[model samples]
Target chain A: MKFGVFYEISVPRPWDAEKEKTVYDNCLEQVRLADELGFDYVWAVEHHFLEEYSHCPAPEIFLTACAMQTNNIRVGHGIVVCVPEINHPVRIAERAAVLDLVSGGRLEFGTGRSATWTELGGFGADPDVTKETWDEIVRAVPKMWTQERYAHDGVCFQMPSRAVLPKPYQKPHPPMWVAVTSPGTDVDAAERGMGALGLTFGNMAEQEKKVANYHRIIQSCDPVGEFVNEQVATVNFLYCHEDQAQGIATGQRLAQTFGYMAAQLVSAREAYPSRSYASFGLLPQARRQATAPGEQPGVPEGLCIGDPERIIQALKGWESTGTTGVNFLLNVIETIPQEEVLASLRLFGEEVMPQFKEAPDANIRNARA
Target chain B: MPIYGTLALEEYAGAAPVTGELANEEWETDQAEALTLSYEIDDTYRLEMLPAALHPSIPLYAQIMVRSHGSSPVGAFNLAEVRLMTRAGSHYGGYTIGAFANTTESVEFLRTRYGWAVSLGDIALNQRHFGARAHVEVDGRCVLDMSIVHPQPITPGDFLVIAGFHLARVGSDLRLIQSEPSYEIEMIQRGKPRLTSIDTEAFGDVRVRPQNPIVATYLKGSFKLGRVRYLIDPTRPATEGTEQI
Candidate 1:
């Protein structure tokens, strides 16, 4: 079972410069600690122009910097907007190959068509063309890696005969993954032979059906990639500690902030132009008005809030989905203190992680026999 | 099986060049109009299309682009077509779109500079474009879209540069270009029978000069019959790249 931490650089409304710096500095520090603790992967999301919510616009650069500080943990592009407008296929191929080379094959290429209007519109990409653009780029990267001096005269881009050189360290290119917000995409990823990074944020019962459908399609897929890395992974809000009540108190507000902000960004496109990068599209009327006396924004579901024993019982449901890994979205909105984040990692690693860690000897011993 | 091929033209009969123009003077707006042009290839051409089920093992599309060689300078378009044909008494597949490609002299720009070379045994190339010397493949007969634009003031020699390969050929070539790689010209050809070379440039930086420069191609086999060529409307720009379902 692989373990990773998901980052959005989230900071809730009452923003300050120092708080922002601390969020990132703390995140980098958390990644360093995670590496020391034997975490498998460190993932970062690539979001653009969503001020206050996500400042990780230049994720490739951040991942490159992360590559230096960590030795064991794999660096990941949790999701690089794969549409041609946001990043040309050639550009994506070049960046991914360079990172794979730098990381010594410890890179996983996760791709997606943007869900928010701000990013998609900023690049002048047509929503109608998003899926096709995603499919073409995803299918094209492996070719660009293997082909010598490749040129493509497709609907999106045309290049003259020039070798796209410096192939990746991973054979047949780096591992391929696609972010799926909906269950339909899970099956699409399986059919295309890409790992499913399900960010649906739902219960174990929902995930079970999603994973079962994905496995069925994967069994018959003629992958566009070099190899079939049939794996499914998911992310959930996490704040674990020795005392269950304290863990909940520390995680609740920040988790709610991350959840609420993500939904607002996606839903805003319906009311205004998604491509209008200047505006976040959050109209005054849409803002959550002050409820009657003491109420606040609704609490989000699927959040893991408890001690090791309770968290373990909640996570057992994840195994039912047959997922290979689960990324913990910690430190959302910076509600938890830096020390608390580190302690949670320690407690979770000592008690919770041991149960899920895949024995290194299992695969080797099976192969040798 | 060979998936697609192009028709030989005794006289190059085709459409106008591509010009980047907006639907309106909507300044700074993201909306832009895209057009596509298409052509059909005959049975004599050698190329094959594998079934979709055999994807990574066999790439689904072989993309090509076309540039202006006359007074009219049409922009680039991608070609992907699927067709059924009979090759040596067997059914094969084809995919073609409207686009332009570089002549033999044009592709050499990639290899001579960066020592870039494609392992053609793995991908498919048109015998009409690469000639008999290059390792072009074909298992069955199929149709393809190779968009070749003829700019205005039609002259004897003019063409666009075409590059890129199917999955079998993407490797160090992709990496080098991404990391500031260069290319050189190795071969040049005029028409279908004669071939030659000009000069080389960085693989990523091949340009079409003076609007209409004469281009060349090398044919793999001799043809006794005639093939179809397309002539598109000058006002209509070619929209021939990838299309979302």
Candidate 2:
């Protein structure tokens, strides 16, 4: 499986203007080094009004910076909120095309409807219409890229035919992806013939099941764009070191804070806003843990943490799940220093990535024998 | 303590269905004048008042005042209530924290039919030349009294953003009580609201946080209650050629 680094660009409470700059600079520096280290992608998110949990409302700017600074690592807009209110489809099309041009066509246009109540409610965008809006926007953006002059009369926009300009450097357009937080969103991506940008953390068993369903469904997909991006990418946390103890302790702490920050924005669980949110699973997982007294809650085994051996073992589990790529969330809650983060990336590239990179060729030879 | 999405059906449940919709489907209400004032609340109120099923993250407290002369199960009357904004995962929902009406029948209709934990109280949202004011008093104590002025009116969206889900169990189906209230709003003005009176802990003990009063909108048109829908996540967000219901 291909290796990529993901970013939420979190800045915990007691935040100020300088803290945000430090976070951004640190992320950029990490991206530059990851590209040099031969990492495949650098993914980031777009969230608004979520406070310190995720300060990245505009990710296209950062991705553009990545494009200008790095030569190899694909810059990913892990997602650009697709709802019309949050961002008009027309604006997204224009911006994405320009970015792809600058990045020399290494762009993954991932899209999603805003999940948090703070974001949805703040923008005055209706949750009821988000799914419909997301589908419409995702389908329309690619056409805007390929077609010389694009015009549409759809549920979201109605205009007399006019040219949507700045077609990308990619032949048709950059590969399209949709962010999948819930289990079923994977199926949505498959059916629509888009790439599945898996946002939720899951174990090998869960990943295997999800990926199997995805590959099965994608076989008959009638794509929204001209071609299907048949790639399955899932997220994982990474903290690599020679010392197994240090890696687990540091990585797990960062992972806990990662979960906490995510929970803060979306967890109205056990409250009125979360009445329908029970399906999101974190609360349900916690509730089930409450049932079995004295049992330590299972840290999601999907993350590639621990020393090189343990990290390789964990990643091998994910590789068996049929994922095309693994996006590793590198720094969370600022628990790991920037220098340590760079060191971990360096370690991952030097020791772990080579095996996975060579495994496909080895597998082909074994099949032949 | 982690406040993300949680299943809140149980928290919102326990209010007996008063609409009698299961028995009959002839209940409809249209043409009403109302004023709604919304506020942002602290985490304390968000955790305490809303239940786990709701996955309460956005702490919303709204006071709605209505005067209806049109048609409904209650014929014609005046009523009002306080709604707390909630969410069931991604879906927006609300709880009737406290409610009050001028008439006794409306009070019973609200509680027995709509499941609002309402008590007898005075509620009004009035247009006073310069601005609009919302005042609510449960029993003898004033719970909500806030106003906004310099009515800089604009075209309101087709529907008000204030509506949310009312989680109810009708039989075995987990019905997400969806509300799409359309307003023939002749006026839509947004501005800073000034709270002159200060008594948040008078009524249901669900304190109205005095800090951040976010955005306020005043409407002068008729309101219509839309049809309710069943709340099913479909176990996944993927669609298999299934048309949206």
Candidate 3:
């Protein structure tokens, strides 16, 4: 299974002047370290003008820098806003190609429509049209890469025959992925023949159900993409230390805070009028409102806090759930230091990755049964 | 050669306080949280912040503006590298922030402030149309400081013209007060008024508008409409003429 990490570069309220530089430098160092550590992929996100939650508004620059710094880990646009208003398709192609070339062909193009109303409104994008825009632009990328000149006419965007150069390293285009937070989007990705970067924010059981649903859909998909890339990836909070209690205790509040923060931000623009409306423990509160309090968050739910063994157990639950890959969300909310984050990565790579490091084809075959 | 579609955004410095998060695992959450905090706490709004070394330090601002539904030669009257200019002053200043886009959604189209050229990588437009263009003026003088579709699409039908421009952070918050449009968004939407026309005797020599026009509509940024052109920059003109192409 492929492994990747997500970056937000948060500098929470009561900001320190040096916070920004430190976080960025540490990130750069992490990418360099991941490269040497035999990690598979390094993914970055693209966000615009949001305080505390996200600082990396321009992820391409960061991704490009990572491209130059590392020789292995496939750089990812964990997502580049595909909406024309946020980013035009042509620009997406150019940026992806440049990153691919700079990184010597290691680029995975992940795309999505901004879910937040603030971002949608800011970019002048129609919230309803986001999904459609993502599909159109993503489909257009490959054609742009392969053909010297092509033209398009659709509901939203239209282009004439023109050469789009600096094609990506992967033929047709780099590996394409669609970030899906819901199962419907997962099935939708499968329908389009795109890899499901499943952002299934649920327990291990829910993830398994989602992955099972994806596999079924993919097996029957006509496949819009060049190939049937039916991989399902899930993101889980992670923090590893030699001392299990220290890892859980130190990471508990931070990990829970991270989960609550992520859920709040995702639901914010739709939930409340302002960001301060984000109260701590909102996720748990929302869960309580929706379900029984005694219920666990999910198998892969809550923070994967503990020693390496516990973390492995959490991941294995997800693996059984049919997850093709895992995007271990280390450093959630920044309670841990860089040293710990790296050590966690090293430990996971050494202890966990090996357990699943067989031939991917074999794994898929075994999982299929 | 890497043919880049270079364009410019005039007068309006796209957005304020180009904020960015570091590239770390928490990068996603940090950015989302920080942005949410700013929107919640700060009274102002920011636009078009994409990471780029275009200006070494300054981030690229994605500005959306209204344009005609046709192919227009996209270029500015002039280009230069100015330290910084704004609505209130030459440097740190104030702004009359206005919201643009469909009413149901709080969409704000970014306008240009200064005359600066930018490379938007090459792109093409299809299905052009006609319509009235949206304007953001300063002191009644039409600042050529907005995004003009130098290389836009040419077809038939009104469009919700969208373009991008360069900008720098002005202040923490530029309080926006929305007033009635001096003209009318509906009229522009329905009547489809034409701003600067091509093929005119005076502007004929400019090669201003290509034979076709770009359609302006509220593209929902949807992908269901398969194989659509997300962005179009006519500035990086095709090597061959329209007929040949």
- Tens digit per residue, CA lDDT, model 3, B48-154: 11111111001111112332211111211111111110111001111122222111111111122211122121111221243222333323433222212322322
Candidate 2: tens digits of C-alpha lDDT, residues A38-132: 88899889988775667788889989998899999998888999988889898999988888889999888888876665676667765546778
Error of 1 at B72 (Å): 61
Best of the candidates, lDDT = 2
Worst 10 residues of 2 chain A by lDDT: A360-369
Q: Cα deviation in Å at residue A364, candidate 3? A: 11
- What is the model-wide C-alpha lDDT for candidate 1? 0.50
Error of 3 at A347 (Å): 2.4
DockQ winner: 2
Task: Specify the highest-TM-score model's number.
Answer: 2
Q: Write the per-residue lDDT of candidate 3 for residues A18-79, one digit (tens) a residue.
A: 87877887888878877886777787778765456567888889988888888888888878
How do the residues A46-140 of candidate 1 rate in per-residue lDDT, one tens digit apiece? 88866556889777777887788889898889888888877878888888888888888888889988766456545656654676778878887
Quickly count the clashes in candidate 3: 86
lDDT of 2 at A112: 85
Order by lDDT, highest first: 2, 1, 3
lDDT of each: 0.50, 0.66, 0.48
Clashes per candidate, residues 3 or more apart or on different chains: 77, 42, 86
